[model samples]
Target: MNLDREVIKALAPTGVLRASINLGNPILANTSKSTGEPEGVSIDLARAFAQHLGVDVELVVFDAAGRSVQAVASEQADIGFFAIDPVRGAEIAFSAAYVLIEGSYLVREESPLLHNDEVDRDGCLVAVGKGSAYDLFLTRELKHAHIVRAPTSPTVVQTFLEQELDVAAGVKQQLESDCRKHAGLRLLPGRFMVIRQAMGVPKTRGAGAARALHAFVEEMKDSGSVADALQRHSIEGASVAPNEA
Candidate 1:
């Protein structure tokens, strides 16, 4: 496929395509047990995008979603995989979502909370990853319940358990994996939100770069590349998003 030089230059201004990879979201990315390299759907997509541009891909890894977003927003990285949110949109130009992941709350089995709504009442303390999609959304939407921020999305459960917080909020799969390890932790029935996972570049990258990324996202989704990547990584509890509506 012929590529646009200006778009490629805008996206890979430093001579190589630098993609921010967040390992906090297990369904999107994780460390390879053997090679210790980042691997997951997001990494796969990033490599594919850089390959399409005829550029070598470099993974700028972060253990938290906020750090990853900040990397892209600060122009430290060329692109990033992120959950699309209004708060992050100020500095990031996000493509239409290529995948959808469920955001859920986890509570101790003995806890009284059974529904997502019940966690919002007074005296309830929810643990969330600092600057995560759940934290940003809850900060804007929640009126009563208090929020306790963990250092990263992957540590929400540990924070919740250690602090005895009322609930843990994060990716459903992460919570599920934590529940299996810790026991006595149960996810609230259903999901509180559908996270729109997408590729993004700094808004300063220009409209051409943004449109190119957006079109690439739509193509990845429509062509089943995103779905195939999920399957190849054995990722469950997430689905490829439909074309931008």
Candidate 2:
């Protein structure tokens, strides 16, 4: 059967949502190195959601995760796809999480930090994305480490590449993706935090909109569509958790 027309119409005019881009993982960004267009997991998921509603998609790109959420809060876009944190949930309505993630640190393979818990010892420079969950975790847990906040994940990666920091922390997927792209970078074993990634809708959009979108996501999960999408995109370490709604 055809999906709801109203939902499709709501998305049709511009057919795009503003998304945060990570240059480290071109696959997750849905980027075509040749065409300069989005092509990865987020793009596929967002496009499928739009297509189910019978609409095309337009992808607006933002360089930082913080700005991605801000785009939705500012009504610069309809929704955002990223990791959902309790703090961000308080500011924006979140759909049921479609992916599970863990936090980890990326460091040079030869760095002493790779072998010691003392990596977080006093005066060690750790790079993290500003306003990101990793930054939040560092503030609370890595008290001895001198945290250096980068505005974006790519920048954090760049800083670490430049040997300017002892560690760069972020989602495990992102860290692994970086490791594959850059030699001599390795991810630490233990996770700092477990995360669930979801779509974010603006708070000002009202409860009904949030409910509708949440229901749509729930339906996708229940029907195994979300799992299929994850597999289709070859996303590793992602699974849909049980949803109350």
Best candidate (score: lDDT): 1
Off by over 4 Å in 1: none
Q: Specify the highest-TM-score model's number.
A: 1
Query: Over the stretch 79-174, how does candidate 2's per-residue lDDT look in tens digits?
Result: 777677777777788888766777788888787765436667988888888877677667877768898888686677877667668888886787
Q: How many backbone overlaps does candidate 1 show?
A: 0
Give the lDDT of residue 31 in candidate 1. Answer: 94
- lDDT, residue 199, model 1: 94
What is the C-alpha local distance difference test score of candidate 2? Answer: 0.70
Predicted candidate 1 versus true structure: per-residue lDDT over 186-226, tens digit per residue: 99999999999999999998999999999888888888899
RMSD of each: 0.9, 3.5
How many clashes show up per model? Answer: 0, 6
**Could you give me the TM-score of model 2 versus the true structure?**
0.81
